[model samples]
Target: MSDDANGRRPSIRDVARLANVSYQTVSRVLNDHPSVRPETRDRVNQVMAELNYRPNQAARALVTSRSQTIGILAASSSMYGPASSIAAIEAAARLRGYWVSTANIDASDPGSIPEGLAHLRAQSIEGLVVIAPQVRVVRALAAQALDIPYVTLQSTDLDVDHMLSVDQVAGARMATKHLISLGHRGIYHLAGPQDWIEAEARMRGFLEELGASDVPTTAPILGDWTADFGYYAGRELLRVRDFTAVFSSNDQMALGFIHAARDEGLDVPRDLSVIGFDDIPEAAHFWPPLTTVRQDFAELGRRCVELLLGPADGLESPSPSTIAPELIVRGSTAPAA
Candidate 1:
């Protein structure tokens, strides 16, 4: 009797025989051999799936000298954006049948970045997906050259790949321009803390919009990405009565800003027009629902895996058409008083 009668785990040979293909053809399909006939490969894969076949990872790794494990090296994933992105990356990698290893570091610590990379290297990860929202993390990674293929989610403008989805600069610019179009000349930007790439990009976009419109911007208040910090920033801005509108780097901050403003007897879109990024779920429920930019974190994660596995070198020169943030108009923003 065949081993199948004993309810043994299915193997590649069994799948090959079931599909009526040679063992070599099965192997080619497993390795994604480009020369293999598409129909034959599909047939082999179908049978393998039907048989609930599982590849021997140890054997495959030994044969190819590859771990078949992808590493997610992330910085400060406590924030919604990074957290959501990591989850999506995991989902995408699973669909491709690759193991995922995660290493999260605090971007505030200069040494944390290297430590995360080292942890992944120890796992013999085939490639890396770096989700560094901070500029310093990228700089540190640059100092330590990566031997294996790595994909990053930050826009470095350096001729490297993995600058996938999310044109944060454009998104920020869109938010700022929307405020400007509403005649908000005295726009105050409550930006993210320094060293973060997204924070810097968003700041640049805010400044660029203010400069082009011949409007002098109020000194930006840089704060940690937190509701409490946003509240603090909002109260502090009240001291400088020059700005009529404020653009926060994230929705959490915007929500806090609104709360603070309410305490100061400021009605949103009336006494102060506010906008934010990321469009977090609660943004819509905030007092006078917030106007914010929606970033596709899931798509970004999917693309990061694709780029890491595929040739991401061609993505060095950014194509802005990749991921466009949609501006969600709500009650938070209005014409300056």
Candidate 2:
């Protein structure tokens, strides 16, 4: 028995000898394996509690075929949705006793992302989770063949297994319907870039909601997912000055619109009611706060992992899973005046 500089406790081997069990048996009991006999498991557990023993994660991984690692292919962007989704995935993976290897990609370029994904595949990863929402990413994925089971946190026209995403249509509808309910007869929409799936989904939802409303709908004002685009678009929108409310595709554009409104001397929620999607961290802190849809991104991560690792849910015409968006009522919204 090796003694510490200040010897006070016995080691795992000592516990194994005292319990009359193999070191492997002791390890299994510590891991909470169901196969261990009840009395032996309890006795080993009691001894471990007394000795304060812990298993090394690296050692455990060597024995199990699972490396306890998950690979994440994420887009590096200032957009709130992608950033929040990565954070959630990391947190959930850590909680499940798995380590994560992330490959940050540029969503605008498909080649760069595929190169990074190729590197991840070389690591012999058990599973892959991709946070791909852009069209370029989709195009790249469509061109490739995957050897391992994986999941995508995206909304695509093509059908695939293990997909988790917020119902963009639902969120758009919620935003527009909220504005319409506030007596805003003329509602303008500031949509995201046309190429993105999220932008298309939001636009579809907005059109559907407006079509359902008794009031007439106006054509959308196009903008990129940036405050600068919104600023420019907002400035142009001021020329018309007919709408009472505006629904922005995302928070960044909404912020830009708010700035533009201020420059034009229009008070938010008073002169012009505005609604935005993705209730980002700073949304509540923005001037007069922002009334937006809260998309649960972390939950998306957990569900994606579960589906990918879960029993064969079967790919024979699998139904799409839709997570509803939450409508957050904040200071930036009010009845149309």
Candidate 3:
């Protein structure tokens, strides 16, 4: 039986005719209806496979009113943290047999938030994951009054019940404490953009640690979370060279800062100790490998899916809501000279 005997793609009716079963029977099999006999279901499935029949997901969704899809509302998605979280959520959603729909919006524009939500809601997503890392974005999302189960990846304290995040403040504190333990009092912080919630939390952690240790605080230099900014900041900051160590918000900036340091004839961890966040793939390969903080992005993704859809079968219950960040000590940091 050819799929295009009449010059049209094969339909469920084609499978039914070839398997000698009713179209209703094929529909039951497609839905895993238990009333269909095992032998009959097997035959229909075999015919479907033979004819390369694929059910129209949109049509099925219309009939059942369940799209089996999740939506991601993202802003600043090009950055490493948001980008990684989105990828993780997609991978986890796929494992659970759900399709993912993403709607990217401008974090700076409040109007784009509702527009993005409306676009995803039209697809009938069963759940939503909000990857808005900015404070204003989260606040804008809250005003929309979304009805579906939703999880926000950033910890803004705006929606504690719906937030899942790595403890950014604690992670920053860990990085700061590591430098302090090494006897470095003259430390400077390279923070992400001021609007980012993670950046704010990290800066808070750094400040809190400095206060606890009685180390005089220096205002953090805000950057756009790029190596280019890090390079320029490094060049300007190094002109005075008052600080003995620097803690960057992310690894890319750390890499750039290191480059600038080298350009100025400063050896990393010898002239200045450096540490970064995210421990990006290239962190380990930097000239003197980057000592940085690591967030379990994969685990974070799995948890986001589980939170919105519940735990997967045969798997343990979801771990704690806040994933702890790990400090990976490497060659970039050392005791201040």
Q: Which candidate is the best by lDDT?
A: 3
- What's the lDDT of the predicted structure labeled candidate 1? 0.80
Cα RMSD (Å) per model? 11.8, 12.7, 10.6
Task: Arrange candidates by lDDT, descending.
Answer: 3, 1, 2
Model 3, TM vs. native: 0.81
lDDT of candidate 1 over 56-170, digit per residue (tens): 6635666889887999888888888888888888888887778898988887787766666665665568888888887777877787667887777775664255466488889
Where is the poorest 10-residue window by lDDT in model 2? 311-320
Which lDDT tens digits does candidate 2 get at residues 59-172?
A: 355578566777888874446787787778778777777677888888877666656565565344678888777777877876666677777777766545566688999999
Candidates 2 and 3: which is better by TM-score?
3
**Winning model by TM-score:** 3
Clashing pairs in 2: none
All models: lDDT?
0.80, 0.78, 0.89
Clash pairs of candidate 3?
none
Worst 10 residues of 1 by lDDT: 311-320
